[model samples]
Target: MLPFAIGALRAIVEMLGLCLLGMGAMALLAGAGRQGNPVYRLFELITRAPRQLVARLLPGRERPLLAGVLCFLLLFLLWLALAAWRAALA
Candidate 1:
């Protein structure tokens, strides 16, 4: 059960990181029109929570892209840590 929970958490972290990366790519591909793109919106929706958390952490900062990048790095680190933990358990 513990390993199962760790695996689930790791999966969620990986998904969010991918969403952040996809959002960055979509933003680049669509330019200023990314807001209207359904795929971009979907990625944004999935990553909204982390962006919001980053926003709250850095009040008055208007750089959401930077926040998204930070979130991606943090999630990546977390995923790595979870993998290590699962390996130790095994």
Candidate 2:
């Protein structure tokens, strides 16, 4: 029971982190589209690192919506994996 509680807590924390990361990425991408300023570029570089890595491995053009869906899928998978790990440990 204690192990289950701990696992749930860990999963919640991880979900929050992933949500924040996804939101930050979206914000940076939004900034990248703005005209007449380079400030967004810095954020774009930071947030784009993961997407760039994915793109490199996947090797394809991805639409914004598709990217968003992928993020959601990845987060969901992470949550599921964590939950499964917790259950197994218990």
lDDT of each: 0.90, 0.57
- Off-target runs (Cα >4 Å) in candidate 1 are none
- TM-score winner among the candidates? 1
Instruction: Give the per-residue lDDT of model 1 (tens digit) for 1-90.
Output: 999999999999999999999998988888999999998999899989988898778756898877888888889999999999999999
Worst lDDT run of 10 residues, candidate 1, spans 54-63
Superposed Cα deviation of residue 63, candidate 1 (Å): 1.2
Worst 10 residues of 2 by lDDT: 35-44
Candidate 2 segments exceeding 4 Å error: 1-49
Model 1 clash pairs are: none
lDDT (C-alpha) at residue 41 in model 2: 46
lDDT by residue (16-39, candidate 2, tens digit) is: 446546555656666645434454
Evaluate residue 47 in candidate 1 and report its C-alpha lDDT on the 0 to 100 scale: 88
